[model samples]
Target: MHLDPRLSFLSGPSVMAQLMRDKDWSDSAVGPPQEWPQALRSVVNLLLGSAFPMFVAWGPQLAQLYNDAYLEIMGAKHPGGLGRPLLENWAEIRQDVGPLAEQAMQGHSRYLENLPLRMRRGRGEGEEDTWFTFSYSPVQDESGAVAGMFCACIETTRTVLAERDLRARSEWLQTLFDQAPGFAAVLRGPEHVFAQVNEAYRNLVGGRDLIGRSVADALPEVVNQGFVGWLDAVYRTGEPFIGRAVPAVISRSTGEPPYEAFIDFMYQPLRDAAGRVDGIFVQGHDVTEQHRSREALRQADRQKDEFLATLAHELRNPLAPIRSATYLLRSPAAPAEARNRATEILARQVDHMARLLDDLMDISRITQRRLVLKRERLTVAAAVESALEAGRPLLEAKRHRLQTNVVDPDACLDADPLRLTQVLSNLLNNASKYTDPGGRIAVDARQSGDSIVFTVSDTGIGLSESAIRTMFTMFAQEQTALERSEGGLGIGLALAKGLVELHGGRISASSEGPGLGSRFVVELPAAPAPVAATAASPAAASAAARPRTVLLADDNSDAAEALAELLRLEGHVVHTAAHGLQAAEMAVALRPDVIVLDIGMPGLNGYEVAQRIRAQAWGAKPLLVAATGWGQEGDRQKATAAGFDRHLTKPFDPQRLVDLVGES
Candidate 1:
């Protein structure tokens, strides 16, 4: 019977019992069976011998072989292969084992390498080939003639194939690791030895061979940089470390500047299959360009701040005299023609100086992010009209026609009135300055959605695309040298933008390139308030009447004396104080009607003196008028909180000051 390959061998005792029964049957045969032919008895013996293993017996020659293991390997083939030629039954051994078989037949034992053989068990049974080690030994008959061969073998194909596949994958992985960029390296052990490094890492370390070397030994500089400590920590705890924009200086043997590098890197711990920490894997990229760019930007910002401070100091010095001279020239006793000419020169030059001062102040405030707004509800049309009124002189002098179109006369907005008017006036004045004689400039207002849109359109020299792009930037102007000489410091639009943003509004400019005129639009949110009429009060006319006693304190003697003279001319008794201590003394002795204090004085400033005066019990407290150059919102708050009753900036409107004192 045939057996499957998966079955186990039968026990030796069972096989022996079966063999004994077969021998008894042969011996107890009847007279006719005993008298059977010797050839048939020999056939039976051959079949029994073929049942033994460790013998390559086939084709009627199995009677010569003997071994139980061999019989088990060729189970059920015993009887069929008895006394048969081995080559006919096992065709696979014809090439290699054939020679061995022939050698065995010549009374020689043969040892063969792993060889292939095919075996058949019964008629019509398919054949199978298996790998094996074949050892052939001759089996001889009693006459010493050649009979058959015995063989032994083992299989080694599975182990060989598995080893070959592993080697190919290892080679491919090694190639990929060696070719990677950006300083890739594998470290091993707690010491972080350079177990493997890519070409990038080799180049970074000055072309030195680093494999199999400790990190500190291969690159001693890295140890000084604390990289060794970082690696050790990561390896010990199996944790990762990531650093960005780390600055380093690389030294080279070649005569060159020590190159600076900003590095972004990661140190990751490597682990084995059992999850034990083995090494650290490092990867890094250089960010030198980004570092340089940030440094350049910082330098530029510092330079801009320095320029603004210097400009403010230098520009303010000239402005004070120009303003004082203008005030002196506005007297009524001068000749009509000479007075008119002086007034024109005074207005024009004063406007020019004012624009310069405003630019410097605006730049300082915006850069420091201290610009504050005092918002109030006002009509858009009223704001536009106020701006036009302020710019009327310039428009008339330029002979430009001013047109107004108010589609939404009742559109009110919350904004700083003075600052809002300044924004509109700047736009109108710019329009008038750039437009030719007889050209028309139009101011229009309308409500668009929740916003009130105010547009100032001018038939003026238009802006180039490049100029328009940078027009709202400080010190950016579209005007040529000749046009600039006519007037402008190119900061109006920048100031306008800051002021508009302070009021939660927006300003924009549009033009069809140069020579096609331009339009500036401002959109502000609407509010709920009636537009007040623009009428000057007759009370503003009651000037030139000063208090009975006026205490003037200023560190600048020229300013103090000049102001004292003006106060005296206004019929006030004037007392002067040069500093805070002097002003306090004078306040006690003079008991003046009003104490005009100057801030920014050496030692005790105006605020301190005002506090002292208000706290004193020797005399009646005078009306305190702050008349200093500090005009920021914080300055106003400080003045008020310090017990001053009125606040006025330096080079202020003389008429307004006279009126304030007269009222007091």
Candidate 2:
């Protein structure tokens, strides 16, 4: 019964050759192979009938067989794989693949896709990494008994890894595109139609629904400006374009006006693997606010330069005439009468010019934080009286009637007496300048709790609501169609407000309307100490008492001469000097009660002059008064530290000059 070794090997080959020949015959004409043993013939028939090339192995009752296609699919392991368990021949597939084989042996068919097999082949010296989609199906004998599994498979690892890598790349791109702050968009096709837009791009396009729309349809204006054509050119040529500071205006369906935006952006073409342009990507950032702020700052700088230039030009015009008149007056051969007349004219015009300059300087100091208050204890009544006396000429020139209702005359406050007087004088002067002839101006003060309220009201043209709102702003002016007169520089109220704030007080303006009147109220904290009985009458009592000799020195000869003349008229002997040397000689010879020295002099300055005078071994030392344009706190401290008894700013009131010179 044993077959020869040659015959056994020939048997499998011959059966496979016969089956291939039967492939050309009809299925009905081909009967199953009967001459072979049932076990061997059953295995051969099962292999030939399988949908896929397969191999199977069985024990005792059945025979194992492998098809020609299976021999080719397995390569070198063909005949040797027969008559063996499938897992034993492919041992590396045992872990996850064992159940499939068991299911097939238990009379069921099993299919697995992408089943990884790490098999060691007899190729070269090492194992090869290969993947397979394998299936295991049960085989049956002639009596319909189950046999071992037939294994079928195909390799599929390349496609799986490629799909996974593509998915990861897609997710990363989507995340980055969504989180970008600037606008981003994709335009597809030859027409540059919008394929996708990020959140920022959607907002930039006026928040309209724009996907799938052509660039021309979404923004017709952009098409008119050739922006769409530019994008098309980039897409067609596959060339990148970059633009910076491209000005653009966007109009939305909403009623808002078209807003301006400066755009810096790039257009990059999306190309296929062969480098054919398919789409375009746009990225842009908005720089509107930066542009506007820069423009505004530039305009402000230009205005500031123009204002300073104009101020210098205007000031020099008046100074030229005063200088010419002073040179004539100081000539050796000049007649007394002519000299006096020339001096008077020079003094008047110079005083006017100096007032304007002082106002301008005050405005500058207030704006630059250089102005300071010299605070002291003072009566509100005295401040009001001083302001009235200082502003009497203006009121008289306008023929205005002045009234007073200062009930709390003894109420004293801690304030800068000079600044308080300046504030009141500015208010009075403004009233007189705006009021008509014969109009009434009133100065009133009263006590309100721990504070005193001083009001300067005038029967002048009232302010409109708009005017009142900007009344205290620098450079603001009231508009009057009936009167074409030039108004003040509009810095007085602003300066007053700054000074009041420095003293921890408040000042405000009010009016009924254009024709009624205007009133300014100043409220200040009263002094903590009780009011003195002599406070109400101190100024008057002091003014009537005495006249003293005074020496006035200033680099501005017109100012010094005018002040000396005014002091002489007020019953004080006054000597004038155009320089510090003349005044120093006079001060030592006369031993004057007070020496008013100008801080800014040619040779010897006020500080050095005062020091020299104080160092002299004289019987009665003169009171050193620093008369200078410098009125800051540090300037006052410098004067005091230099042995100056008092500091007086330029363009000071003539009566105040007299009072400081001991005329009251």
Candidate 3:
């Protein structure tokens, strides 16, 4: 039968309703809505005319009918979507939503919020999840029997997904802020209430309750320090404040006074949606220890400068007398008394300078751990007597009376005898200088338990407690000087201490007070109980008296000339060259018994020349001696590797060079 014209399919407002009207529906399981029973037709019209996304699954097959809004949700599946089975068109979502439709067909009405359904919509072939809050209700027939399901759904995919993303991002940001190494905090609103705080921020503030409180109220201790004002200004003016090494008094304890801390910090303005400043973002780090370390380095640099200046003054003092004495000796008509006095004075000054240089070299060698000691068993009396001989000149010059007493002359020490003698000499000279004219100085040694105890007591300018404590420290005498006229590098006593320690001994000083005299004592471990074994003493070999050809290569003319003269005096044939190339050339021509190479020479340095020489046929024929001022251990190792027989420092004892070349 034909339907009434006014009640036909054309009575709908949506584009889908109109499309459904024009399309053929004969092949569909439910046929067409106009031919369906009144229940299905009523529901289909309601679904089609609705502004919201609505659909009707009519008949047992649950054939789909929906409006334009629902068609929009279907995307490109629209035209073919109508009159088809709901299960067929949206098969991916059938498992999740099909049960709801079946419940409606069973006469039950149900509601679902955010029902997640995996579906492929439009012409897109891939299935993705979409969410919706929807209701499914049974559509009743004229007799009250359920025939289909009427569905009203709202796609909440964009809204739900956006909300989930926002929550996750918020959690991630919270984790970062809490775990940041430096301090961090966030405040909200005009009152600067702490909206968020991290662990580092809490530690910075001494673990106080900071969240939900204003800056002034939460950190009252820092308000007077101007930090709170900085925060307020940032919030009010919408600008940032940065500070470096800012001093803050933080009370880590309940009752104790606050301690100071240095902090580097920044306060940035937080703005609202209206572009009005609301609160602040605070970040900072502690830098107190770094500041103190820099200050200490600056102090050490200043002390080093003072030491160098003092060293220059001490070295120049003795040169003035030596220069005057040299001028006197050079005069052709000098009288006998004047000539002898000048000669004596020149010799004394030279000896003094040599001692200074020797002390410096010894200290340097000790510091580098390159002091090769010739250790042997010797009597304490012999060592002390040798030291007294060395110090006799200074004792006479100062007019200091000397006395000696040995309780056991046989007291023995296992030590480097030369180093031991030098140590005692240093102590004796120190005592003589500090003592007034006609004052008494005594040297004594004895056997005490398993150690030998040697004491040098002097009636001199004594030491205070603090002076005694620092007497052996390098460069420790700036304030402890006896007089500016009596000058010396303060390293003598420090050198003595180092040498004594190396010999398994201890040296100490005791003094009542200034001008009350002082006593220095040395204790050394005695030689172990003697064994029955004995070895023959080797006789010293005399230096080579016969002349041998020697080549000296040095950039310094005066040094080369002086060395050549000293070697010639020993009756050796000598050839000299001022540069490395000239020396290498002379070596091949002369074929000398020895080649003395200076490390730092112009053009082909000592190392390069040595390499070239070693490559030659006559290279290893000559004894190679690296006589240089480069006294460092690495320099010596390099010389040895470059095939040098021996390495000696510059300004070496003339006799040592003679003995070395003599052996060659």
Candidate 4:
């Protein structure tokens, strides 16, 4: 056989040296020893020249490797077993070795003396009971990651059998305690002295010598954390106490601060043969990562709930104003001037509501990863101009001073014009709303590095550190959400973050503490100018069309009555129903020209009502429209499938509804 390639690197080798020169190892799982890495080669040389019985089960599959002494222990399996997988040869005793090797691969080392394994050795009667004193340690690759296991084992069957009855029972129990996985220690008497401790338990106390030490002496830091008290209770009561994910601060290694850890632990009372409690057994497992992940999910769930409540309050805020304006216009005795002013108020509130709905849809699309930008080549001035137009009214209303600085107004950049403007607009509006009235605001843009940079600075109420950190997080203040005197579901900044990221950009917020003002910066990648398209002429607004009789169904009395009043002012004869079943009855009897249904109602739901109404044998069917608060895409699809000709989410433009019904 050809000499192993790695043998040349060794200064001197013994048994494996001859085997490398004579054996054909080409078909082994580890391949030829010649092709092995320097590290593996070094380890093989140590095993070969050493007097100890050492073996290596390396690589992902734990391929077998051994020295001459280990080969002697395997007897008949040695000659052809050089590089086979470890589990294949030890299949009969796999239950005992599988987990040991897997744990070793994870960088844990285990030691066991007189451990039992059922194995079929040469001419063994059935499965023979074998005992060995073994140590399994992790073998590190050149990169220092655990590659597999390095085992040093000694067959102790003869020694163990000779002293089986002569050995003290306590020694056997102690052996079992050390072999157990996880952190383990046996305490003696009420003082809970650490009579015996495993390497795992010793490591838990920062590698301090824990053997023969009392619980209080070895881990005084944990005393204040109630561990000592729990131990005392278990000792006195003689009852096992189990705690799951218990928070603790312990020094795991020397020179490191006491890091927070969670543990699932149990303290069981150990009894002597006399049946009296003699000691306590402490066993624990670290669960910090799992606990942290679960807590993060719970916090997110709480935030979402808070946002939902805030959403409901914000939706109702504008509805109240629109409702009051409708009442004023619906009165026949109202002056013509009052009616005109009410009409203006109603239109403004409807527009505000529509914008809110649009924001919700935009944020939803961004979150679901469904938003796609229509990129175009344009100057930063165009985006700035559009954003300024959107924010002007708010600035005017607040009487805030506004300043603008465009480093190069004509400098071209590639971007999605509408979406880019939206990101800036949300920042401006956030500044305008959060700042005290008559405060200062500034907007700027420039080419910085390979990025197009912009900043929106505000002199309103400055942000606190906590607020700044979570300001761009969705539903950050969702819990306790109902009241938004400042208005909105707090979605603007979160949506802005998503949009900025989509454009291969980033956004950040900073403040000089509360009352000192805040600044938000946005940066987008710079790109070369592209061919510009000819601007299309803006279409003229459609003229108001004729109206017809309309029927509105909703469980919300305030919303239903207000909407009905608004339709009447639009010259439509309006009827309102407060329940789905009632609306279905009315639709069959009156057969209004248009039927608007709410999805959620007492008795039957809106979907069922629409379905039932369409099934009616009417001379002429009315136009079916879903006008409820359920505004998801799925809701729209379901509404269409239920025979509705049109779908409109709540707070939709009143004029749009009139036009839709007018067409029929």
Q: Which predicted model would earn the best TM-score?
A: 3
lDDT pick, better of 2 and 3: 3
lDDT of 4 by residue, 242-355 (tens): 999999899876678888889899999999899888899889877788898898788778778877887888779888888988899889999999999998887787787788
Relative to the true structure, how large is the alpha-carbon lDDT of every model? 0.70, 0.73, 0.83, 0.82
lDDT by residue for model 2 (355-391), tens: 7777777777777777766777777678788888889
Better of 1 and 2 by TM-score: 2
Q: Write out the backbone clash pairs for model 2.
A: none
Model 3 residue pairs with clashes: 76-122
Candidate 3 similarity to native, TM-score: 0.60
Q: Which scores higher on lDDT, 1 or 2?
A: 2
TM-score of each: 0.53, 0.57, 0.60, 0.56
Selected candidate, larger TM-score, 1 vs 4? 4
Give the worst 10-residue stretch by lDDT in candidate 4: 476-485
Candidate 1 lDDT over residue span 1-664, tens digit each: 5432222121133443244233323322221223423433343344334443344452233333334444544456664443345665455446755676667767798665544455444434676544455566654444555545455544433544465568878777778777765778899988888888888777665777678889878777667676888888898778899988887666543555566678888999889999998988899877778877887677557545744664565466556666655665777676677666666666556555655665667666876778777788888778878998988988999888888999988788888898899899988988888888899999999989889898999988887887777677765555442253345555678888888877788999999977889999998888877657676567654533434688999999988898788877888888888888898888888888789999888778999989988888743357899998787768889999999999886667666666767777
Q: Name the runs in model 2 displaced over 4 angstroms.
A: 1-182, 195-247, 251-258, 267-278, 316-352, 370-540, 549-562, 573-592, 601-605, 608-623, 631-634, 640-645, 651-655
Residue 300's lDDT in candidate 1: 51
